[model samples]
Target: MKIPSIVFALLFTSFSYSQNISGKAYYESKTTVDMDNFGRRDMTEDMKKQIKERMKSFLEKTYILTFNGNESIYSEDEKLEAGDNGRGFGMMMSSFSAGDQYKNLETNQLIEEREFFGKQFLVKDTITNLRWEVGKESKQIGQYLVIKATAYKQVDPNDVSMMRRRRDRDNEEKNEAEKKEDTTKVEDPFEDLEIPKEVLVTAWFTPQIPVKNGPGEYAGLPGLILELNVDRTTILCSKIIINPKEAEAIQPPSKGEEVSREEYNKIVKEKTDEMRENFRNGGGRRGGGGRRFGG
Candidate 1:
């Protein structure tokens, strides 16, 4: 006997939703900085305000984390980008963060596709083994029960993002070399020369979500991370969906030139250092430009 078309459709729908418990989580992230640390001694208050307002996109962002039980992909959501036709001179900016990341918890491996200055890099490396100390504190985020966890993370002071941001904000007229000698306080707020860098990370994970995942390189938890705060940035999971009608295949990104994290770091440093040398010699600095991506 042949099955009815309606019955077949119902069975297919049930199978699709029940096959794997995949989910898409929406997160809202924001960053805050103290501009006074940059030695803006001569700037008027109005100038500072204008600069801050224009930097909202960099300070605030939206990201999406799609995951299943064993694998996940996290990426920034597309937004209306402010074009450069009218940004004026010296306003060019480039993103230091690269590539959509794919992670496999079973093997402790990660594939991140990174792009810098029209160059593509597929970064293959091990996921950071975060040592999370779970606390007895508990709270409620929406409908999920969350528990607090603390971690002391050692930050890489020479990361490309730090240099790029400082370069972007540095004034061409100022002598950075001379200013570096003043050790009392940070003469260049935009520069990242301070040592002993570390961040105290506080994370909230929900046991209901049963996935060892979080936003942007944070994981190895018993449950899904709902909220994370580190230094000036905060990533908070605003929405969650479990086992929807459509099953998403969390595939690893494989479209860039392969390289390791150490290699990529070296590449970024050389490029940045070259740009700085050119600027000092009056050949005009490479502005890193804005949002360069090469497949």
Candidate 2:
């Protein structure tokens, strides 16, 4: 006598959920940059190459997500190298990096730690329920069969990390003329920066995991998300351990002053505005190196 397909599925689901399962997922994240489109137009290819090499740490990263059925903790696997103080340009890019994040599916909550300009902030926000358009397309990621889902997520306007330089020479000339006309008025440094209001996010999840969790603030999937394509970044799950012999507890970060996500973004905008203004006014001048900016 053969078991009914629906009955077998039900039994399998029940058995999978009944166990106290916990595991870790290791992810490799890579973000691509069009070197030609960034920085100054006069920048040589060798200069761009050097800058890209310096930015490798920020562009390529690894993270580990420790998760169970209801909650998960996602954090970077920090690797300390000699002289890797994350200084200079790396320091500027570090503002875009996210710290440890904790998500609770049952409560629909997201708590994350973010460091901006040397200040640590704990951001608390509700988990956004993405309107995923699940497709029939499927692929194999490792041993699990994963299905594709796509959604358009609203981009945070004050997210400086998402900002890109608008390559408009006319606008630059106009700004320069205006600056010359009115030396007293400080120009808005963000005038040339552009960030899209929304970005398409493509995700792949495996129903076999039976967990609604993923890296960063992405959640609400039917299963564990194995890969994500958001903006210019591609995050892929490199390895997964289900029910390891020892599992670390998923703990929410408690350090730093607590603030809502909106509040934090506001603070970041204000601080960035001040910093940009200062830099424009020669606040970043270095001795022996002369002024970093030209009049």
Each prediction's TM-score against the native? 0.77, 0.82
The alpha-carbon RMSD values of the candidates against the true structure, listed in the order shown, are: 10.3, 6.7
Which ten residues in a row are the worst by lDDT in model 2? 286-295
What TM-score number comes out for model 2? 0.82
Write candidate 1's Cα lDDT for 1-295 as tens digits.
Answer: 1223433343454444433568999899988767664334578878777777666766688889999878999998865354442222123244354669999988999999887766778989888877788776778899877888888887665564533223244553455545556533322222443323667889888756767788988898767899999876889998998888986888899987898878887877766555554444433423434222345
Which segments of model 1 are wrong by more than 4 Å? 1-20, 80-82, 85-97, 162-196, 286-295
Model 2 alpha-carbon drift over 4 Å, by segment: 1-15, 79-91, 167-192, 283-295
Q: Give lDDT per model, in order.
A: 0.69, 0.77
Q: Indicate the TM-score of model 1.
A: 0.77
lDDT of 2 by residue, 1-295 (tens): 1222432353467456735768999999999887766655567999899778877877788899999989999999974232353433455566554789999999999999887655677899999988887776778999988878899999889877777656555665566677779877544445556778988999988877878789888987677899999988999999999988888888899977899988988987776666566556654433433323111
